[model samples]
Target chain A: MSELRTRMSAAIGTAPVEATRRGAERLAELRRRAETDYPPMGEMRDLARAIRLHTLANLHRYLSEFCESAQRAGTRVHLAADAAEANSIVESILRAAGARTVVKSKSMLTEEIGLNHALDGFRVTETDLGEFIVQIAGDRPSHIIAPVMHRTRQEIGRLFADVLGVAYTDDPPQLNDIARSHLRRRFLEADAGITGANFAVASTGSVVLVTNEGNGRMCTSLPPVHIALVGIERLVPSPAELAVLLEVLARSATGQRLSVYTTVVTGPRRPDEEDGPVETHVVLVDNGRSRVLASEDAEILACIRCGACLNVCPVYREVGGHAYGGVYPGPVGAVLQPALGVGSADLPFASSLCGACREACPVRIDIPRLLVGLRHRLVDRSSFSWLGLGLEAYSRVASNPTAWRLFLSLGSFGLRTAARDGWIGRLPFHASAWTAHRDLPGPGAPPFRVWWRNRNR
Target chain B: MSRLSEFLARIGTARLPSARPEVRAPQLDATDLVSLFIRRLEEVDGVVHRTDPVEVVAGLARRLGTDRYLSWDPDRLPVPGLVAELETLGIERHTGPGREEVPLGVTGADAGLAESGTVVLIAGPGRPRHPSLLPEVHVALLRVDLLHRSLTHWMLEHPQALSEGSGLIMITGPSRTADIEQQLNLGVHGPREVHVVLVGA
Candidate 1:
């Protein structure tokens, strides 16, 4: 078995299936609500897709334009070619500012680059409730939106009790209060704030953040210095373009017309401004995105990190996000990880190709087509594989009428011998793997070809 | 080439489409925008008070059972003499940095989006970000004329709203999170209750 298979099996064995199911169900409910609430859902999605594609196709122009405008607006823009470069740039920024404690909102880009691990000496705290829980537990986030989706309330309650020295209670609101009180102090005292941009408007040189909890606002406003790790692809030409994307983002992510807070930071605080970060740095991290853009699956960049595909995905619903073995999980992750050059080769084949992801995708990314295309690329690259050999053998037999008839007869006879009550409960060797999960129907006695001939006669 | 130039070079240009797609503003009949805005705001757990800003503020303070509150400077507010009204009502207005133990926050909105029940707030010197942020409860004084149909419409109309301030935030509802077992809990780090006092509605 591959490493991904081993991790998936382990996750399936240990991760609570009930919690994941409930999370998926809740996401489905929210998605349905969002679709119903936004009557122009389809039209907005088309506009969003067009905007994303246009931005990507003309990324060079927009990126340069954004950097110039950001600089003009008093934002120091840094371009990092890879994860290491990005992490180092952030570290140097912190070091220069003499920042001791850092409060951060939920930023997948920071996770992808492993920022916390790099900032070992500095007191880094995740301010977002979900991310804070993940920080305390010393665990990886299972879901993109709801990081602790796999964790139960009781588990979190105990984690707070053990870590924060608070009394145990599974009540969500009470738990929220505890985090609010604890992190509020961190927000006040923290030397710097770090965040990820949902979209960067090139024209005005602004970073857009969408969040329901308002932690995004807290992170951007409370700290003296702010650093935003933005993926190169997270850009729109103007607020007009941003408006279109924002319309669909929350609805697609959590089924809200708008998140509780949608903040647009143009730059560091103005001299006359009483509050907000005095120093702002927008680090544009490439981190294999250019590689992805060069690949056949470039459309994956169009994703807004909504995680809608994860909710509707049947496979993800079964095994949960940990099984995908990456920062991003579910259908988007399957294509994205490999495209980013960080995933197992079998990641593409992990899907059922139901096209539910494509359907759920607000950007209308053809995920199924991308998965198939990746599989094709994998096959072409590999020298040998059981799948390739099996296909080669089947093709030779299938092309010749006599060989095809003999192969079918042999397969039918073998299946017939194994059948009990006209159902093959188990089969010997590798075929038993299929029967282990579900029973297979025995081949008919007259066979389909013979039955067709008889019916015609 | 510099690092930025090198990075940009990696992302080579593609054939551009002749025309970019345009996003249409949400259709809202002029007569019903205020009512529609109220309903949408209510749906998101925000309270909408249709009355004079002064009475709304006084009522909200009384309802919350608090005498002291934080707010934007008087001149920045849409309603004239709001501070005087609060003072007359014996509502103590707290000012200066550090909003500790403040129960309610009042401010003026830049614009009100009817489609999503959103209030756009721009950060400035007198207009601190935390009055609406750090407090447990927040109230905004929005004039009827500032209301727009949607974010798209608002952006199309007020392009300079993006560049005029250091930052702008569009608040739809109170702060909420569904992180714990996908069970939503309000007021995680920001205000739990958001009230929009629509003046001259």
Candidate 2:
């Protein structure tokens, strides 16, 4: 809690002001456009939710179906039970191909597994600009969708100037040009490519990546060997369901009618095809998703990695993504941290429980409920702490009217020196944690029981 | 038990087993699909031109510059003599992952999405995936009849089409990125401009 409080307070000035502003504006525009552009978005979300729930309910069947279909379509499917296994599988695939240089698209699952840390011998390049920026800075992604959302343009310009030995320009198009020139060479020279899946259609054996930048296409097409690391929960039962997810994913993520490229690949390059990867490997990584699938918090598995929840979260807007201290951040990260046992247990308490995240979620995950559940598990399911001791003592007092009245009178008498203008400017001792940000009024009114008795008379 | 089997067994034990319900997407009926497609394409910063097959080729020749041009193989070309016509018009048609500096490239769409103005291209003998991408400007000649109501409708009708073992790329607009301060810069790493020439009126 100390560390969490420190990071959160530190994030006051560092929150992404411009990026969050732009995201908020774009999301409002998306909602307006969605009414006329697509069918009723609410009904569509219901369909999307049902589809995800169905897939999760029958995840094993769907995953197995995906494997069989992908194998039939000429992709070699490997099941990795954990992050270590997933990373090793990727390493072996690259090793067998004698891959020296590898180009990778932005994959959060890869970050979750710490894949880049294991590849000591290979030159790996992150093709996406946001991802490339983070990789160069030796930082993890702050926002799931916009990896470098926390960094301002000027900050990025300075970083580029310092690192890439190029002229600094805050101009986005110029920054884009610099990144394109930088990554274009990597794409050509790399022997293998890796990407994350937006949705995996089980019945069709297709790996779909919804991306605005064409880096996903480049990673899938340019290299001789392509390996896709897909979360097991990413699977959908059919192409029809894939369509449903795609409809909501882009609109929810960046508020686009469609992302620039939806690279739907069934397998590696076919016999008659000329350009795609020579050998394709599909790595199905559970990495704690199965545990989530079994848990009462299974609705969190309905996430499509859209980042809409992040956009609308009040606390995220204030504290920003880095404060979450995990591969994921925002409202979605708050749930995953506790669910996967990855990051701080204090994450669930980070939110205001406003339910904005649930409203913004495309699949309608009850994020606040999950947050409450985690909080309940943390306090009730643990050994006694100072707060617990205080609560136990207070419970005894609260149970007896005489003791409660006596305690309140003693507290009021003890606070006489601290009281000024019917308010305590700052609380004394451990209670200062509350008064640090807010002033506490000195017993402004009679206690509830006293007021109740007087009002009835 | 194998990890896969064990996972399935765990799923079997966890919670009340729910049936996988059939998901059907709501349909949007556009009185004029071609018009709807054009409007949607325009909204996404994609340019669209509607003309007859001859104009499709000739208009492509006229407006789209004839420099470092790459088109789908002869079989995938819309008209039989489109390749010859382009060559006659002094457009240099090359093959096989040309230098990264592709100025313009052409291909035909297997399906056109009216809902989002997406063009679906599948990798095959004539239609390699490279030409549609890599270039700064991509010219996709879509047949009017191939236009579908929505992506869902297309999938529902052609479920097996996905598992046909080809690289299918669905493009709604040119390659774009808003990652930097959420300011969108089109044609980042992929094509900068995508022009859909509706082959038939």
Candidate 3:
């Protein structure tokens, strides 16, 4: 908790956070647009969830079928049990293709598997403009959709000038055009392209990629060899279901009715097609997803990665994506990171359990409930902690009415020095850690039980 | 165990509740398809030629600075005498390959979606993916009869429409991005201008 608070405190004021605030604005607009665009939003979310549940339950069958169909479509399918295997496979494919340089579209799966770090010998450039900025600035993505959302234009301009030896300017068009001209050369010269799938259909061996910049299209088309590393869980049944997912994905992510580009790449180029890649390889990566699938909190596997939960989460907006300290951040990240690593147990506690993430989630994963579950598991798995003991005693006291009333009255008297005008300016004990950042409301009135007794009199 | 076998062993074939919940998403509320298609198309900064004779394309072409023209098969073109008009306009037309140097590209879409104003492109003979992609200006000739109501309608009726090709795309708006500080820009890689000429069947 001290570590998280220090990191979050360090992020304050120095970070512009305009992008995250705009992202939150974007999410509210998404809800309105979804209501307008998809019409019956509630029914659509329910149906989307049902589809995900059915697919996850029959995951093995669907996965086997997907492999078969992809093989039939002339795509070589490779399975990775862990990140090392996935990285080695990617490297092997590049080596076989004799690829020295690779252009990549933004893919969280690659980030999850730590692919960029593993590709030590090869030259890899992130093709998306925001990703390119982060790559040059030597930073990881702070937001999923807009990676450099936390940085100021002035900062980015300085990075570009220092790295690329260009004139410094904060103009968006100039920066975009700078990235455009620079990446165009890379696209033409790179030997292989790597991307992540928004959805992979089992019935048909097609990979659906949705992007606004059309960089995904460039990465797939301009290169000679294409490799798509997909998390095993991002699969649905068919194109019919792909339509349903796309409907929510666009509105939920950027508030667009549909993104500018929704591409379906079946496989490598056909016998006579002039463009597209000559060879296609799909790496089915299951670093920790299979573990997630088998766990009790398996419903989280249904996420579409629309990032709506992150955008609307108040905790996420203030502290920003970096505070969570995981490949995936925000509410989904908090629930998801613990399943991957024991070290990430602190992530789940990062949420306020506000239920906003659950409300915003298109699939309705019940994120707050999962965070509570993670808290419970933390107690059984790890050693003694003050939170566990405090919560344990508090719950016991909370259930007993007589004990609870007495506890509240004693708390008011104990907090009188910090109390003024119904708010606590500071708190005593280690609990003052909370007040170090934000003020807490004082025990303003008498206990409800006493107030009720006085009213009756 | 092989990873697949290990995974299969861990994950048994448990039949979840059947997912056929009747979620009715009926978005084809527009009785008039052309107006709806044009309205949706225009909303996305796409130009639609709905007037008679399809000569309205000539006006749309005026803005594009058509120095050289590269298009799909001449047989598939819905704009009557378009090639002759290009010749008369002193524009050089080249039809060779992908990654060409032409500025204006013309092609025929297999279908146009009305709900989202998307053009569905399926690759085939004379449709060498480049005409719609590599050029700065993309002018697709759409036959009115080929416009579909929505993705749902297309999926139920023609599920194999996209799967049969090496690549299939449903391009809605022009190639764009808001990647730099969330400021929208057009023509990052694909065609900057997307104009559709809707001709009578």
Question: Which pairs clash in the backbone of model 1?
Answer: none
Tens digit per residue, CA lDDT, model 3, A1-457: 4677777667655555556666566656756676676565666677788888888888888898888888888888898888999999999999999999999988999988889889989999998888888888889888878787777788888888999899999987787778777888898889999999999989888888998777888888879999999888888888888887787777778877678888887888888676788999899988878778777678788899988888888888888888778788888888888876633567777888989889888888899988899888877777888877999999999999999878877777877656778778787789777898887886646656678999999
Q: What is candidate 2's TM-score against the reference?
A: 0.94
TM-score of 3: 0.90
Predictions ranked by DockQ, top down?
A: 1, 2, 3
Each model's C-alpha lDDT? 0.89, 0.82, 0.79
lDDT of 3: 0.79
Which wins on TM-score, candidate 1 or candidate 2? 1
DockQ of 3: 0.53
What is the DockQ for all candidates, taken in turn?
0.68, 0.64, 0.53
Error of 2 at A177 (Å): 1.4
Off by over 4 Å in 3: A383-427, A434-457, B1-3, B10-28, B51-66, B76-81, B95-100
Model 2 per-residue lDDT at B106: 83
Residue-level lDDT for B94 in candidate 3? 82
Q: What is the lDDT of residue A292 in candidate 3?
A: 81
Instruction: Pick the winner on DockQ between candidates 1 and 2.
Output: 1
